[model samples]
Target: MTLADPAQITPLAKAPAQAAPGAKQRDVRLDFFRGIAMFIILFAHTPGNFFTSWIPARWGFSDATEIFVFCSGMASAIAFGRAYDTAGWRLGTARVSFRVWQVYWAHIGLFFAVATLLAAIDMTGAYDKVYIGTLNLWKFFVDPGPQLVGLLTLTYVPNYFDILPMYMVVLAMMPLIMALSRVHLGLVAVFIVGVWVFAQRRLLAEFGLADLHLGLPAEPWSDRKWFFNPFGWQLIFFSGFAFMRGWLPKPPVTPMLIGLALALVLINVPLSNIGVREFGFDWARDWRIANTIWITKSDFGLLRYVHFLALAYLCWVAAGDKGVRLLATGTGLLARIWQQALAIILKVGQQSLAVFIVSMFTARVSGFVMDNIGRDTWTVVGVNLAGMCVLVLTAYCAGWYKSQPWRKKVAQ
Candidate 1:
């Protein structure tokens, strides 16, 4: 059931890609939000970046993870949905399978490259700290045999390396959801919801019940699970997916709805992790500790899901129709500057997968640089700005490669 009146609750609006009369139009909103998330993720991952304290997570229950997963779902709808519609389910399945393979290698490559970098840094004896130890990868180096096998099988997932694995699992669920739509859209909804419910085993167990026993093992020996549990995270992922696929209805932007969403966001500020720790609110801390399960990141707890939706709704409304408000139209210098800035953001979002891989590696290096130097006010700003520049270059280079200038016809 919808929260709004039936009249106001209609299928979600499609972005106006307008390649042809009936073709899907590109949604600037998705790219804008995803671009913003890329910057936030960079800040959040950087070891001593005080900028992270100002990121969304510090003031709210949800963070860049929500934007990433949710946007991935919407992007998948655009990137993969057409193949399923034009080709049969079998071909669509093949297409998605290829993507999963690509992502699998990317994840593996990221781990090895980063690990090797950290190891090399440690071998130099330049810094006092063991670089590799920061990531808690000692077990992998100590017992490579078992850990290698587990890594290949996705059983040795470390917290820092869990996002992609979780993303892969969520991506794997798309074809099944698509096929379910053929039988009945309602069936697809039920199946998606059922999986999410199963993922909430942890939350359910907290209420004096049996555990749900879901999620992949995060270690070779222990019973630890992946930090980002795809099963539970898929709830939000599929929420964005379904919204793009017209499986769910978008509520009309009403003043009452906006107020409700805004209030929820405000309420979360005082209840957030930073709020409790920084403000020294004993009562808030007590409340948060007792109800930690509700906001737990691993399980994609109910409060986070609710809070994210509220935040997302506010963002959606603020961005305006088709996010046209984000475009700078005037011919003035300021408009030109804003337009260029917007282009960079959109490019970064379009190349999110590549930018993400680079960001992950660069964030570590940025921290290491600061470690060698210092994390002073100016130093912190300088290091983060340097990292952002790398990300920007990565986005531009990725975009250029994707364009394949080599394939262009020779000019006379």
Candidate 2:
């Protein structure tokens, strides 16, 4: 079946009334998916957990990072886009700049926090070699001078700390992106795609432009490039932004398309499995080879892009007006439970920045626990459950803090 016309696409526009100027309406769908992504990310990041293997990454080319970044882009566009619409470009740009500052500091704070945690774990003799080697924390502490400089400059990032730096870069560019989007979304998309292609070919690396050293030593960390190259990842981010801005055509929900999407997901599951890796056909291997050009996670591969698109499409189809009504208004026990669960998730999602930061520390703590204690089934379950509870509590606290009358008074 054919898709609906782009011009006819509409937003849910179901956010509560704003008490202050420049406050954009909150979309529960964004919060719901973001919360889910946070949970998946926290689960997946905890090393040696059996549950990590069962995440969506095992079933598709994309993972929670894609969902997180895409949703973030949509959120940014909604927040800043509205600012620009009402308060003009100056305030919009200021808002973007302020957000960039916030994320930058958050990234710095997270790095130091994780480093301190690692240091504490090391002192306790619970330091896992895997974490140490992956994050290069040993090297970080050994030669703190240059590495610290690099970290401050966004030139050096350890594992688990890469996404925020990329996010900071993307936020820094939001003003330009918003400007181009206003002129024509097609122009913005083309520029983003061009940058992605350039990054994919390692053109920047070819020109010896991987990263800036800022007069620091190139030996340890100053010259190290970002793991999640912002250039390639920007395509996914901007695609989310564009879609949320109604720049892209929205397809009407149809049984045929939904069936096709489900079929694609089903087919991908086996193909993405370890079993398929063991018994790969020549055609499959060839397809894999072909897919490498544009599907690798390092460069935000094309297959990964397509997978997220399919997933987003599925979500769009499933979260229509009728579906939302059923979810919110149903009287059955399971329905009520789901509604309550979504409310909690929405709260977590609304405070995603704080929750995400807390999740990183929790993931590290959970990993440390698994490494020092045990990796048995029950142990894994207990550790994961504890980590999730902490995350939920963090979310609740953040939501409660934001809801306090003092906060409103302070804002006024």
Which candidate's TM-score is highest? 1
- Candidate 1: worst-modelled 10 consecutive residues by lDDT: 1-10
lDDT of each: 0.81, 0.71
Model 2 alpha-carbon drift over 4 Å, by segment: 1-25, 125-131, 202-224, 274-290, 322-326, 407-412
- lDDT, residue 21, model 2: 22
CA-only RMSD, every prediction: 5.6, 6.4
For model 2, give the 10-residue run with minimal summed lDDT.
Answer: 1-10
lDDT of 1 by residue, 1-412 (tens): 0000111112235433411222144678888899889998999999988998889998888999999988887777666665676666898788778888988988999999899999999899877899999999999888899989998999999888898899889889988898888788889878877877777765668674446557788996788889898988988888887777666777799999999999999999888877787988788888878987788888788899999999999999998877878974999999999999999888788788888888899999998999988999999999998988898899899878866677784541
lDDT of 1: 0.81
TM-score of 1: 0.92
